[model samples]
Target: MKKIALMGRSEAGKTTLTQALKGEKIHYHKTQYVNNFDVIIDTPGEYAQTHGLGHALALYAYEADIVGLLVASNEPYCLFPPCSTCTANREVIGIVTKIHAPDGKPERAASWLRLAGCKKIFYVDSKTQEGIPEILEYLKEDGDVLPWETKPEADGKKRANELPQEESQ
Candidate 1:
């Protein structure tokens, strides 16, 4: 599985979602600093809320193959600027959480992420693990390309013998 970086505003369920993705029991732990797990990087919301700390996300993204920009369904506004993903080198995807909230408006939150330039979007309720499989599938497939994985040089076809050889130390 590819490592994912979770970034969002405070109380947006970043930690909760991280736990869900890891198949662990959800626990509330205030993320005062960046928490690096084997397959996830949970960032403090302040990093995304404070402009000065915002640059830290770019640095964190370097360590992840996927960057998840989360927005709660009931969020009143977006913290991210338009086309934010355009600045990221890694694949940036949007996640809309709290889909089960009474006042949840996942569509609105999704639109905000779309405006932020996320190439793909997912809507999920971390509490129930709804819609989580799609995210897992995406993470599994999207980042599976090996460094030496070869592509068709032409004609949209690649022969087995033409596969790029893995370098030996």
Candidate 2:
């Protein structure tokens, strides 16, 4: 499964999403520091909110296969600017939480993520497990391979971890 790093503003449901993904009972737990799990990295909202600590999130992004930029449906403002995903070397996706909130505007939140360059966006209400299966399916996909790391086999299939042989002079 692809390792994912979740980043968002305070009360964005990063911790709740982490628990739901792990199949643990959802509980309220403040994330004071980066929690590195086997397949997930849960970061404190302060890291994303404070300009000085934002660098820490970038550093952690390196350790993940996918970087998830989360936004609550009811947020009045977006923290990320246009084309924010360009700064990430890894695949960047958007997760819109609180889809079932009384005053939520999921579509608006999704638009913000789209502007930020998220190739794909998912709407989830962790409390009810909505959209959770889709996330699981995404994580189960095979990790990406660099062009130089794959070699074409005789069967016309690309195989990873096998470099092409050099041509003889």
Please give the clash total of every predicted structure, in order.
Answer: 0, 0
Per-candidate TM equals: 0.82, 0.83
Query: lDDT per residue, candidate 2, 68-164, as tens digits?
Result: 9999999999999999999999999999999999999999999999999998999999999898878988888567443333557778775656544
lDDT tens per residue, model 1, 59-154:
999999999999999999999999989999999999999998998899999999999999799999988989787787777755454322345546
Give the lDDT of residue 148 in candidate 2.
30
By TM-score, who's the top model here?
Answer: 2
lDDT of all predictions: 0.88, 0.92
lDDT value, residue 133 of candidate 1: 73
- Candidate 1: TM-score? 0.82
Q: Candidate 2: which stretches are off by over 4 Å?
A: 142-169
